[model samples]
Target: MSTPYRFPDYQVAGDADTTVFLLHGAYGSKDYFREEIQTLVRAGLRVVAWDAPGYGISPLPPEGLSIERLAETAACLIDREGSKTNIVLGHSMGGIITPAVYAARPDKVHGIVISATAGSFSQKSAQDQETFLAERVEPLRAGNTFRDTAGAVIDSMFAPTSRGPMVDLVREVALSTPADTFCAAITAITRYQGEPNMRNVKVPALLLAGEFDQVGRPQSMQSVQQQFMPHADFVCLPDAAHYAFAEQHALFNEQVLRFIRERVLAQA
Candidate 1:
């Protein structure tokens, strides 16, 4: 018999009619969505941000890290906190997991927002995948922790012009990730075949890409839209990179709220 999966630790805010589940990236926790949470709450939308397994205070799954496992956990959380109108919003690695959550529980998800991620790692060349893995894991093998590499990693995810307390907030969130978690997440992410899941997203969908995002480049996301999510709305935020939600919070929030209002809520 298998042990029941443990739900990750999460934070809830607002009491609005619509609930937005915020999932952070590889090196982030619920706190990474702090700005988004506040903004969404102020905009009258309920928000739930989670610490993906092995992140923040959440315990790692006994079965280890996999995108499927992450999707299952997210589905369970949504079942618990879901509203009449539920929107699952994910960034970077979390973005890859969003569609999987929809595949897991289509009835519960009314909308999905995939931010700063490509459709699948399978789409990348063998050399690109290897380079991605080596860049993240090599430092850990060298006895360095996420704290040691957080600054550089975070710096690379933002637009060159982006700077301020938001940058500091992102750095702090990245620093909190455990080395084991970081390594496991990078491995799981690289191995994920998400195109099938992406194609399965039948709900109202929105794709947000950072204009300067090299990690999940805007061009790649555009390709993803053409191939799998043709029905979904796509927006490339100007002057923003992988961390567009923080780098350009106002624009990011505006698009999200707009999608919910026009695409998701209007139908309701």
Candidate 2:
């Protein structure tokens, strides 16, 4: 049998009965969600944000990075941090992993919030997917570090109108990722087939999209919702791009809390 993956380093706050698990995107870490965590905590909800395997202080999994392995790790963490109600909130690449977590241990996940992502990376055309991987990996293979490429990549993730500390925060988080880990993540993401997992999700779901998001486009998310998760509530945050939670955090938090109260906790 293969060795077990290392449990990620995480932060937890609040004592509320409901728990929100914040899983960041490929370019993010637990540190990136600090502000959002505080907001959730203040709203009387417990929050747990983790550094995905190979990010932050978390040790890289012995098996390297794969969406399947990431889901397994996340499911284990959810079981460890059991709560009255557990809602898994994932952004971008993390969004792709959330449904797999639910599929792995549906019993552990009470609700799911998928932000700025689609049901599958396979949704992209073959050429586009290839281009996506080449653009990110070629630079690293050519000796450019994450710091050298993160700025332009992160810049593209925001709406043209977005500026200020949040933009800087995203750049800083992206820079923190080790080059090898980032490449592994990008590869895993490109190979991921999440639609089956997504279509199988029976639990309540909230799909949050950024209106101007070029990566996880609003139109694509809407199509995913209509095709796979018709029951899920879909909301597009105007003027926000890929990092809607940071770019228009107030709206993002409001919608999240509302979903929990109306869809998750209220139903309970």
Candidate 3:
């Protein structure tokens, strides 16, 4: 059985009826969208970005974390926000989890924005899962700290051309995460089974991929949109990687703001 959902440590901006719950990807805290929050608010959105369980100031789930629990917590947060017409903007593993939130509270979710994520790990074999987890966790277990790995991780996440202060900021925030939290999150995402929920997202969804994203490559993201969400609008940002929004903040924010204004608000 799932534990009762608890509110996570979060930051709020804007005061619109459309509350956007920002779910960060692995190794990221709610701080992930610090740069874009003001812009989103200016475009008329109530942005509520949360530090999901085991990330940032929020304590690790007492019973350990899973995408399922994360979905439950998200639903509670949505309910607390008191909006029937809100958007869920999830990045990376967050993309995998957001659909579950839509399923848990479909009535409340007006739209979903999945950025730089596969939206499923169900395609991975058991052996593949083990290998994936080992490749990430074994190093941390072997005494490599976030600082040691952040540079490489961030490097791989972004294109060479995108490297700059934003990249450094991403690395710095990732460095603050505990090795234990990283492992726990990896385990949860690899073992998650949320593909059905993802496919069943009937609401409007905006799918964004990074042109240089090796993690959530353009083709992979397109496949999800085609196979699962045929109606979703898909865009691949140029000169971007895993953190497409940050790498192309102006365009990213523009797409999201436009989507909400056109697709989401019209429905509401």
lDDT score for residue 265 of model 3: 88
The clash count for each model shown is: 0, 0, 0
* Candidate 1 local lDDT, 156-236, one digit each (tens): 888998887877798788878888888888888878899998987888999999999878888888889899989999999
Any idea what lDDT model 1 has?
0.87
Model 1 C-alpha RMSD vs. true structure (Å) is: 1.7
Q: TM-scores, in order shown?
A: 0.96, 0.96, 0.93
Q: What's the CA RMSD for each of the models?
A: 1.7, 1.6, 2.0
The lDDT values for all models are 0.87, 0.87, 0.82
Candidate 2 C-alpha RMSD relative to the actual structure: 1.6
Off by over 4 Å in 2: 1-4
Error of 3 at 44 (Å): 1.6
